[model samples]
Target: MSDRVALVWDDAFEAYDFGPQHPLKPIRVVLTVALVRACGLDALPNVSAVIPRSATRAELETIHDPAYIDAVERISREVADPYGNYGWGIGTGDDPAFAGMHDASARVAGASITAADAVWSNTVEHAFNPAGGLHHAMADHASGFCIYNDPAIAIRWLLDHGAARVAYIDVDVHHGDGVQAAFYVDPRVLTVSLHESGHFLFPGTGFPDEVGRGGAEGTKVNVSLPPYTYDDAYRAAFERVVPPLVEAFKPDVLVTQLGCDTHATDPLAHFALTTKTYRYLARALHDLAHSTAGGKWVATGGGGYQIYAVVPRAWTIYFAELAGGSTPTELPAEWVERARAEGARELPDSFDDHGVILPRGRREEVDERAAAAAQETVARVFPYFGLR
Candidate 1:
């Protein structure tokens, strides 16, 4: 197996902009790549960035309707509002079509599909597309600032390329509802999502009881966390649920959605995760990939709006760890200045701002809730996986 990890990226990915006022700004991605360079992670031997092209229409049809694709393209070219028909959720406040909407969205999807292909083909043991993970887009509509469901497209690509039993785990603050819906009745793909409970979040779904449909019953897993869930609670829930299920599923490939919106510093969500905790989760998932899926892991970026304070630092450490490089204790001074110039006022001076080590002991109350919920989930689905 190759020790390298492919980092799928390109400057064109910045074209995926909703607008200047939208919270899901493309600057987060730009800053993330800059931070990776500032931390000297770009120089790591095992890491290299790959440019991606827009995905072909056929590849997009795997997860989206052909008519919707055509609508997006038409709106992109005409620069007119098709809000009545084509805008199931498009041209709305969350997903406004820009000049190159179709191409930009397809490029993000292509990056994810490229990463999936690299990992599945063993050209790289692990791959990451921090530009991807637009998981909120459904088969027919866009929602929650997501224009394309890249995770679903990548999983479909994996299945087409001779893989069976693919497992997808989503850690975005919002539920992976679109991806779940795409595979809800397919036993071949197991979708597990750990997110702030849909009761309090957008696209409100992903209830624990809503595990898969028909013959694919129990193939879907969800841990609907309570609001204000901090690092201890988050990690406790993950430790209690994720690993065991992946082991039971025993998938041939592991695809994960690593959204940083759960951070306490993020403006959009209520979860209170720290950067240290996020890094820990990334490292844990990387380890899980090696153990359960022969190191075939495709990681994607999801929702995160705290552009400077959280997203860049968190993702920098994540890519560093994935590249087998040591996390830097301090931020590069030049990067901090550039961020301030770019309108980030609260950027941290160092990557160690969190000042806490990972795998922090689980809190008693959080542990109890997580344990109880996990136990219930296992009981509900363990029989299906024949793990009882």
Candidate 2:
């Protein structure tokens, strides 16, 4: 079997930028694509760059209200008043309206759909749309810096295209509420999200109790860890919850939101992860894609604000894994210099951040809480999959 991987990207993705001050910067995607080239992953024989087209109004309507789509289109034409609140979750501090908002956001959604089509058609063994994974967009409004809810849109596309089962795994520090909401009452798509507890995060949802509704009960799984959750605990929770459920679900395709914001250095959320966690996650997800989903995987990028130091490196690792390649531990000199020229201040010299240890007392407290949360999540949802 060929390990062909499609990198769904277009330079127009930079048009999705919110503003100079927004925490969600386009520089992260820019740096990630640059590092992919710098690491020579783009030059591999099995890897190919695939430029994507914009999502059409009909496609966007599959996951968004037409009124909301119209609102975004109308808002995209005018110069945004930073303080203006045009409703439909636009022009707010989180999802500020800018010119070309609809075009850029629709392009992201279209990119994820392109990845899904490629994987389903067997054109590639896997596909990664690094500019995609705006998982926080709602049918009627946007939230959490997401405008199009690309993962959900792509999942719906898969279902429409004869895929009976699709599994979505989200590891961002924020709950994948929008994706969960999209399929909460449908059994064909299983949505699993592991993130910091809603008590401490934005959108404030994704508890163990938020299982799927009606016939889809037990299909929507959430492992909400406490703040300060570390690499081991998070990975353990993922292992205990995600793999078992995915195996049981037996999805026809696997989709992932590879958000690297759980890194300790991130400015938005609280989790003590290092690049090691991302590396582990990439390897594990890659293995699962082959084992359970017949090697059909569609991956996307999401929340990671540590643009200079973390997001690029973490996502570069993911793309390498998807392409059946490995990255050298030493950071390339030219790439480091480029990041520095782009205003990077505290760059690491290698691909990995060995991470930091918390004080013993704090470590023990956080460990215990995270373990309990993971155990509780397992105990709550395991019965649904017939696992003890």
Candidate 3:
């Protein structure tokens, strides 16, 4: 078996920009690559950078409607509004229709697909697409800054290629609604998401009760953590849920959306997690990929708005773990200089966040809410997996 790892990337991925004010900045991915290179992880003998081809219309149709694809294409040529008049979530505040929107979005989707293909074909045992993980996207519309649901499209590709089963685990702060919706009724695919409760988050839909509808009933699992969920609480909930279900599912390949927006400093989400949780998650997911999915893992970057201090470091930690290597203890001097050159501030000196200390009055409330959410979620979905 090929043990090499593929880093699916292309410079054109930076084209998926939504203007100067959008939180989902393309600089996050660019900084991630630069950090990885600076840390010399890119030079590892087992790691290889692979340029991706833009996903063709037919391939995108695997998860998006043809009409929606046409709309995106039509809107890409127009410059009247950053947000397109075209429906299907196009031209909205969250997902503005930018020039080359179709090509750029398709390329992001293609990176994930390329990662999936590399792992499935044994050209590589693992792959990471820092530009992919547009999970909030639905079949027909853009949502949550995602134009196409690359993770779902990639999972579908795995299914179409004769894989008996596939498991998707999304760790973004927001519910991975698009992916869950995509395979909600397909018995062959299992999607598990752990995120900030939909009650207080955008797209508000990832409750425990939203399990699959028919034969796929038990396959969809969600852990709706409360806001202010700290590193320990978040990891506790993850431990209680993800591993057992993924192991039980015994999927041929493992796919994950590693969005670091769960960081306490992220402007968009309320989760209080730190890079410690991110590192823990990376190690845990790495173990699961090896133990449950034969090391066939495809990982993608999702949401992380703290472009300088959080996103780049968190993803570099993730990539280091994905490659079975040690993470750098200190941020490289060259990377810090480059980040400053780009107008970044409060750049971290280390990979791990010091910690998140909640106010005295808020600690109890946060822990209580977190514990209740985790317990309720386990109670709601364990029976389906035959787990106590």
The runs of at least 3 residues in candidate 3 whose Cα sits more than 4 Å from the true structure, single-residue gaps closed, are 1-3
lDDT of each residue in 101-209, candidate 1, tens digit only: 8899999999999999888988888888998889888888888888779999999999999998899999999999999999999999999888887788887887788
Give the per-residue lDDT digits (tens) of candidate 3, residues 87-119: 888878899888899989999999999999999
Per-model tally of clashing residue pairs: 0, 0, 2
RMSD of 2: 1.1
- Candidate 2: list runs displaced more than 4 Å: none
lDDT head-to-head 1 vs 2, winner: 2
Q: Highest TM-score among the candidates is held by which one?
A: 2
From the highest lDDT down, the ranking of the candidates is 2, 3, 1
User: When superposed on Cα atoms, how far off is each prediction in RMSD?
Assistant: 2.7, 1.1, 1.5
On lDDT, the leading prediction is 2
Clashes of 3: 2
CA shift at 374, candidate 2, in angstroms?
1.5
